[model samples]
Structures are given as C-alpha cells and as structure tokens.
Target chain A: MLIKIKWILFVTVFFMMGISEQADPLPSWNNTNTKRNIINYVENAVNEKSPYYIPEEDRIATFDNDGTLVPEKPLIQILFSIEKVKEMAESDKSLLEKQPFKAIVTGDNEYLKTANEDEVISLTLKTLTNISERQLREEVKDFVFKTTYPHLNKTIDKIVYKPQIELIKYLQKNKFKVYICSGGTVDFMRGMSKELYGIDSENVIGSSNKYSYNEATGEMILEPELNSYNDGREKAANIALIIGKAPVISVGNVGAGGDIYMLRYSQNGNKNYKTLQVLINHDDDKREFKYGEKNNISLNWADKYKWNVVSMKNDWKEIF
Target chain B: MLIKIKWILFVTVFFMMGISEQADPLPSWNNTNTKRNIINYVENAVNEKSPYYIPEEDRIATFDNDGTLVPEKPLIQILFSIEKVKEMAESDKSLLEKQPFKAIVTGDNEYLKTANEDEVISLTLKTLTNISERQLREEVKDFVFKTTYPHLNKTIDKIVYKPQIELIKYLQKNKFKVYICSGGTVDFMRGMSKELYGIDSENVIGSSNKYSYNEATGEMILEPELNSYNDGREKAANIALIIGKAPVISVGNVGAGGDIYMLRYSQNGNKNYKTLQVLINHDDDKREFKYGEKNNISLNWADKYKWNVVSMKNDWKEIF
Candidate 1:
C-alpha cells in the first residue's frame, strides 16, 4: 500500500511537469478577444495542415519601435535632440543665437513643441553633424544606457511594454523573422535594439543620414544629408527594399501616425496566408498618456477597415 | 582473452570516431599557407581564452557574390539584360530598333563586350523597367533556375567554387554572420543567396531601384529611380548603413573592381580582433579566364596592401 501511494504521487508530479513545460507563449497578455485572435491567427498560419499556412521562410513580423513596443509619451528622439543641443551649447555659445537652438536654450518648450517637422529635422542634423558614424553610435548607446524613462524611472531599455516583448518572443518561437520598422534613427534604434527588443541590428530599419568614406584618411564620416526618412509611405517602401519580402504580421500603436502604411503593406502581401495587423491603443490614462488625434485616427481606421485594435484599459490586465 | 580483445576494439573505434569528428573546417582547399592562416584566424577569434577572441555577435564575414562566389566570365547582369531584351522584343518588335536593344537583338557580342559601363547600366535599366518588384523577382528566379554555366555544363546554382562554399560553412560554424554584398540587384541576389550561399535575404545587400506602393491599384511598382548602386565605395557605405558593423572577414575576387572598398572597410573595424581580407585571384587559365586588367589590378593591390590573395591554381585543390 505504501509503494502504490508513492508511485501515484510520482505519476502526478511527472504529468504536472509536462503541463508546465508547455507554458504560455504570452503570459502578460490577458485571455481577451484580442489575445484569442492573435493565437488563432498564429495557429492557422504556422500549422502545416492549415489552409492559411505560411512557410517558415515567409513568416515575417514587423513592429513599430516607439509607441508599439515601448511607451513614447515624450518621444525619445526629441529628448535626445534636446540633450544634443544642450551639450553642444556648453562648447559653442554662438549656437544659443540660432533659431531652433535659441528656442531650446531659452526653455521655450511651447515653441519647440509646435516647431515644424523640417525645423526639428534641421536641428537634429545640425547637432549630429561633423561626427563620425562610430562616434554617433557611441553617443546614442551612452544616452540609451544612461537615461531613464520619466514615468517608469527605468532605463530606456527597461521601459518596454511587457506584453509586446512576449509577443516578439512568441513570433520568434514560431520561426517568424521579427524586424523593427521604426521612424526613429536607424543608428539610434540599432544601439539598444538587441538589448531592449531582442531584435538584431541587421533587422532594425529606420530613418538614416548618409555617411561617406574618406579614401585618403580611411575614415567613415557621417554626412548630415538625410538618406532616408522612414515615415508614412516611406516605411513600407523601406521595408520592401531591405527585408525583400512584405511582413505577414504587423504591429503598431494607434497613436504613431507613420505605422499605418507599414501595417497596410503587411496586410497587402501574398494572399495565400492570412495576414494580421494589430494596433495597440493607449486608452489607459492612469498608466499611460492618452493622446486625442492618434486615438481618433486609430478608432476611425480600425472601424472602417475591420482591423484589430487592442484597448489598453480593457484588453490589458496590467501595464508596466 | 576474447572479452579483453573486444574492449580494446571498442576503445579503438571510439578514439577514431572522436578524431574523425574534429575534421578540418575547410577540406576543399589544399594544405597551403592561405588555408592555414584562415584556420588559425578562425581559431583565435572563436577561442574565448585567446587574446584576439571576438564575441559571436561581432563575428561578421562579408563576401562578394559574382566573381568571388561563382565565375563571372559572362557577367550575370549582362546576361540578364540580354535575356530581358530578347523576352521583351517578342511582344514588341519595335524594341528591336532601340539603341541597346538593336545591339542585343543583332547578337553584336563584340559591341556588348566593349561597351562602356554607363551603356551597360542603361541597357540593364531599360530591360528591368515596367515590371512589379515581385514580377521582377519571379523573372530572375526563373532565369537563375533554368540557366546552366557553359564550361561546367551544370546549373548556375551548382557552379559555385567548392573551396569558397567550405569557407562560408566554416565561418558559420565559428558563429560568423556571413553576408553577400554583391554588385547585382538586391532582389536578384536574394532569390539565389539562400539556395546558393546559405545566406538569407536580409544579409544580401546589393544595387536596387526605387519602388513605389500604388494604393489605388494595391501593387508595389518598381520605379526607374536608382535607390542605391551597391558597388565600389558605395559597398562599404551600404554595409555600414545596413549591417551597422564592419565585418571581421572580407572575401572578394581581385578582378572585381568594387570589392576592394568593402574588404578595406572590414579590416578597418575594431582592432581587438585580427581582421582578414582574402582576394581571390583567377590566375588559372586552364580552369578559368585570366583577364589581364583585373588580374594585374588584384595582384598589385594585394601586394601593396598586404592582403591575402588565394590563387585558384596554387591554393585551391579543385574548382566547381
């Protein structure tokens, strides 16, 4: 009787171990309709026998960097630009007299905030000029490592949305080649891409400035000339050029105006496989900021196009 | 006594098996100084205890596609251009009267052989125009799959140098991410990169034309605008922009004018690890073409720069 009891306990323990080994791919994601849809889509797409099955080679998933993967309440690039101006101002006092630099130096946040897109681009280019490509990368790496997200009080690498991280892992497990198609500088994103999102430098496509190689000095110098501005329709074009194939799954935050093009491109690919477009909506003001324009655009687009939109407040059980 | 003999035999077999398992990384090459240097470099770079050891993430190896990987006696793009013109002329006889089209249609091989670089580029652009990016890829795939090398009487895919193939595999075994930074179209290279060289699409950087996404038609149209010409110095710049790191090992054919820049860029990276630049020399007239200009250029450059030059006849045991 003692031997039989011990054997029964051993069998129970072994069965439980087997069950635990097959743990959830996305534990942070609540068992909501959004989660169910994603699981079903992945199952049908990856399963060999399914009609909508996609080959492992074609399993490409692209995610927007800023708002989709991590919180971008105060855009990181803007912060970096501000820091660059301040750092430059310490050495060159004449920079304080420049229009955008002057606006930033005088603490005119309102004017800087309402500054035109070209003005912001000019400021970024001005600050980053005369530095080698390697130096620029080092600077970005230092900023990413040293700075902390204002609300989270965690380093830039630590402020990633837990649910999205799980999704990236899940996609990777299913042999999906995950890429970050961000509007951020490719150089900057590449610095922390591996650390923050588990995506490699090769897989990060973003806005870029041209760099020239000086044959005489054997030096690679970064030019202020904008090679690619990876935003809006350009994002889709850049993805096509770089990745060679359109993504099967695209994830973007609703508030990011540039991501819609990439999401549409993903859905527009080969019709043999069922494509997925996930738009993350930050509606939870307590945990995250709720922006009006982007939210309105996302709601209207999702409704009209019948795309999946995850409400942060309702769909998410927790937010980090 | 029988049991003792059996135990001895078992030990002998196990010992032999262990020895066989640690076979040479590159067996196709003859036992030469070049082969030994490559083996030594890989060993030092991969061994953690070695002072020159590089991390797995930073172990990048780049190779030129055309002449370095496979024979380019009949340049691939020229052949592709000829094929495209012939295919297009079937539908529109008017194309036969066009400047480059006439030269191709009349089978004026001498004209094509002596044609300037810009003329060749123009012809290529003309042939590749007016097709969707997907259609262009399918066309190239069809061509690559169907065509055979004249000398070897084997398919183009099977005509790769055995020694180089082994080298690529050996590098991969050492945790090196090998890329094909080709002068060919990125789309065309990507189609064969995986099957031919065991490289994925993302790692195949090449010349490319602009592509526009047509929203109304829901199609991606390949525009005539040249996005990037991934050759010469542009190769190094493209590698920097795309891969975000200089490669540890750079392999190129001495005859290919564009590869020297990429090879230099690879060696110019981090100084902690010993960098390698291998220039393939087509000095064997019996096995391959011995073009005077390219051969001389490679010999001079390799000598001047102290880059390793692997002679086809002397260094390699066998060709494809």
Candidate 2:
C-alpha cells in the first residue's frame, strides 16, 4: 500500500511540474531577476482574485521598436533611405544633379548627417510623395522583406529579439494589450508589424505625413506634407489620442524620447488602475550590445522619474 | 394599515424609476439606434459573467479630436500655424522674402493651396524647427489658450463636445484605456490633449518629427527631418508599436485616418482578439458639418471593412 501511494504521489508531482513549465511566462528568457520580476508582475495583475488584479481594459503595454526590438547598430531606416536614394539616382539622371540626392548617392554619410533634418525630411518627402499609397505600401513591403540588416545579415523582421517576442505573446496570453509605438513611418510598420509582432497595422501608430486621394488619377496618394512628429511628449499624446485611455503598464528601452511621457500617463492613479513603468536598461556586452548613461534619453528619463530600471546585465539570465 | 401599505408601494416605485434613469447610458443623446447599440454593447462587455465581457487589457478605446470631440469649423491648428508664420515673417524680415513664409504672411491661401504637400511640409518644418523644444512647447501652449474658433467665438477647449467629454469620463470610470490618435503633430496634441480631453500627453499618439538634444545649448531641439508619415497603414503601425496590443473598441469621426487603421489592425484576428470598430459619420448638417463619401479614404475603408457606421443624423440623440 505504501509503495502504491508513493508511485501515485510521484506521478502527480511530475504532472504538476509539467503544467508549471508549460505556463512559464518567459519561456524564451533565461531564469533571471528581470524576467522573474516581469512574470511576477503580470501574474499578480492577471490573477482575478488578487488585490493587484488589473482589469483587462487597463492592461495596456507599449514598446519602442528600433534598438529595443531589432538591431539599430547600422540605423535600419536611414540605411534603407540611403539605399533608396542610390537606386533612384541610378535611374533618374536628374537625381544625380540634385544636391541631396547626389550627396546620398556618392556615399556621403557625413554630408548627409550635416544636412539639416529638414533637408533630409524634404528629400524623403520628394522621394516618397510621387507614388500612390498602394504603390508605397507595396514598395515598403518589398523593401522590408528584401533588405537585410547589415550587421545581422538577416532581414529586419528576423533580427527582432526572440525573448521580447515571447514576452509580447505572454502578455497577450495574460490579457495584456500590447502596442508598438515607433518613430518609423506608419506605412512601414503596417507592412512589418503583423508578421513580426502579431500586431495589426492599425494598432501600430507612429510618425506620419499628409495623404490625399488624387482626383485625376483616382488613386490614394501620400503627399509630402509635414503633419506631425510622434516623439517625446507627442509620443505620449499619440498614445492618449489613439489608445483612448492611459496604460497601467508601460515598457520601453533607453533612448526612447517618449518613455517619460508614457510613465506620466501611467502614473495618473485614477480608480483601480495601477501604473508600472519599466525601463529596459541595456548593459550587456557579450550576447547583446549595450549603451546608456551618456547619450541615452531613456536613462536620463529613468533617473529623473525614478522608474523601475531593469538592467540587462543584472536582470537577465540569458540574452537573445 | 391600508394607507401605510399604499405609501410604501409608491416609494418603492419612485426608487426603481430613479435607478433606471441613472442606468441609462447617454441619456442626453437622442434615442438613436447607434447610440443605443453602443450603450448596450458596453454594458454587456462590462459585466464579468457575460460572454462578451472584455478584459480590461482588451478594452482599449481611441478617439479623434477635431470634429468628433471639438468644433473644427475654422480648422484651429491650421489657423495657429498660419498666425505663427505671419508673426515670424513680420519679426524676421528675411521670412517675408521666403516663398512659403511670404505666401503665409500675405494671407495668400491660394498660394498656400497651390503649393504641393511637400512645400507645405517644408515650410512647417522650417518655421518650427528653428526653435528649441521648450520654446515650441510654450508657444503651442500659449497659442492653444489664446486662440478662439472664429465662428463659435469660443475657446477651442470650450468648443469640445460635452457629450463626447462625458463619454471619455465614462470610459475611464469603466476602466477602458483611452487614447487620442490624431493626424496632428505630437507636440501640438500634447499642448491641449490633457486640458481638452482629460487624456495625458503620454497616452496621445500622432504624427511626429525627428528630434535631438543639443548638449552645447543645454536644450532639446527638434529637427525638421521628415522621418515618417503616420497615416493609414502608418497609423495602424503606430498603434501596434506604441499601444503594443489591439484595441477592442475604437471610436472616431469620418476624417480620422488612424481610426480606419485601428479597425483594420483589430479585425485581422491573428491573435484571437476581438475588436469593435465604430465610425462617427457626420451627416448632421444642423449640429456639425458633414463631409466624406466614396471618395474619402476613411469612408471607403469603413465600407470595405464593414465597420459599425454611426451616422450623426441617425445615431446620436444629441450632437454635444
């Protein structure tokens, strides 16, 4: 009888362990304090009977795309824009004579960098505005798929952090609403977000240009009108405008200008909403590149706001 | 005994009627089908035991500011931009000689209209980028406070729809995460979003520009770099990037490009999240100006996507 009872107990324990493993919040993440804390927060908030239970409506989460999700060592979008200028210059003989286009085609990063942001914006507008919205969509889609990140030697989509991707899914599983707010063009995000992050195009909000339907051509054309810049405080405003409510939980990496704004938005304690503002401090050097404390905006914000800083070096058991 | 029983019955009936009145959603709104449906849907979704009960995380909502929330009759932002340009042109004589600035100072709407979107964008960037971010923020804040809508003869904030404001507060009360996602600039939105909509700056997402901090000047500066246009697919991408999840319910007027994208983003159902897309179609000539049809991108999107179209003429009991 004792032997039989022991066998049953062992089987029951084994099954429970299997179930717990399956339910691990950060499966891709190595066992680390950062991952553990994140998981614990979600677990506490998601528990229906827990005092910290956040209603599903308030479970809004935000992330920065560029350096946080994918490798930003070579500046992906800028590189793409440069390559586009090169390609366009080859075909359009007039482009070679144009000042900015000529500079870009000649592989002049210094000149391009010195060129005022307005000039770069103007050039981008000129390059992109001539096409129909449909065409632009297709073009961006093709570019994302075809272009590979120079450092990673992989497509931009493929270069996304594996662990972060799992975190997004895990958040969703726990009834958290996740969003990607970037400074990239909304169209480009629409093309890539679904495949890469399982986020729909509409759920992605970013910087934008003016658009109008051409009556003569009967095509939806994107105009090169400078409308709005979704950065810093604007990033916060965009979140409020587009999301319609303040998020209880906001997550972002350093250098994201809008992180402070997000923290402020979440900190407004009204009703049952509890705000958790977390900043991912990239400090790892071996498995992943790290930079902050010098020119990093998020670090400055974290220090100023006293936000929950998750160091990659201290927080993670593994880096992906 | 009979007289006492009669008194008790009357009191009970009066108490029940009062409770019913309080329970009615948007009682000031006309008994329109759209209004009724919206109220019913929200009611059903809020009940914990209901199958349609949306968890707080998925109960994300979005709103458009211009026509939907505030009176956009004179196009407030455009007028402010024009006035700023005029002031700058007058103060700096050189601006008067510049093409777009000169045209703006002269009140040459015809010239302004004649210039392509690129030219307008270039002009806007040039005028705005020359100042520090702090200066720009203050300038915009003062402009919003001082400026009045011409026809209404009221402050822009006062011109916001009372009913819509109530709706925002109501959503907040119910724990729905709300955000304002506009086609307007992030800086512009930040200046007024909190005051007007009770949405904090961080929750607002809109169009943006590339900004950097100048250590030498000890100030944050905005560059007129055209980074991305946050419209259509871009709006959706921004939502995904910033919010990090699909919104279950999205609200907007016909002019909101982000709204259309939000609907699309939520509808793909890639992650098994349910979405409700509501379009505030302006058909009421008496209360609000009406525009858009098959030609309008947003309207076309609604029809193509089969979204819940709430006509102002038939949907609401009241305009404000």
Query: Candidate 1 has which clashing residue pairs, if any?
Result: none
How much is A199 displaced in model 2, in angstroms? 16
Q: Evaluated with lDDT, which candidate comes out highest?
A: 1
lDDT of 2 by residue, A46-131 (tens): 88888888877668888767666765555555666687788787788888888777877888867643443234445567676666
Candidate 2 wrong stretches, greater than 4 Å: A1-320, B1-21, B109-123, B132-134, B215-219, B255-259, B269-273, B293-297
Off by over 4 Å in 1: A1-21, A43-53, A111-120, A148-155, A215-219, A294-298, B1-21, B115-120, B148-155, B216-218, B292-297
Give the C-alpha miss distance for residue B221 in model 2, angstroms.
2.0
Candidate 1 TM-score versus the reference: 0.90
C-alpha TM-scores of all predictions: 0.90, 0.54
Model 2 residue A155 CA deviation (Å) reads: 25
Q: What tens-digit string does per-residue lDDT give for candidate 1 at A1-320?
A: 99999999999999887775455666777888899899889988888899989998889999998778877766677678888899889999999888788888777867644543345456667777767767777777788878986676888766778888888988898889999988777877887788778888888898888878765555567688888888878888888888878898998877646677787788775555678999988788887767646257666766766678988887777666
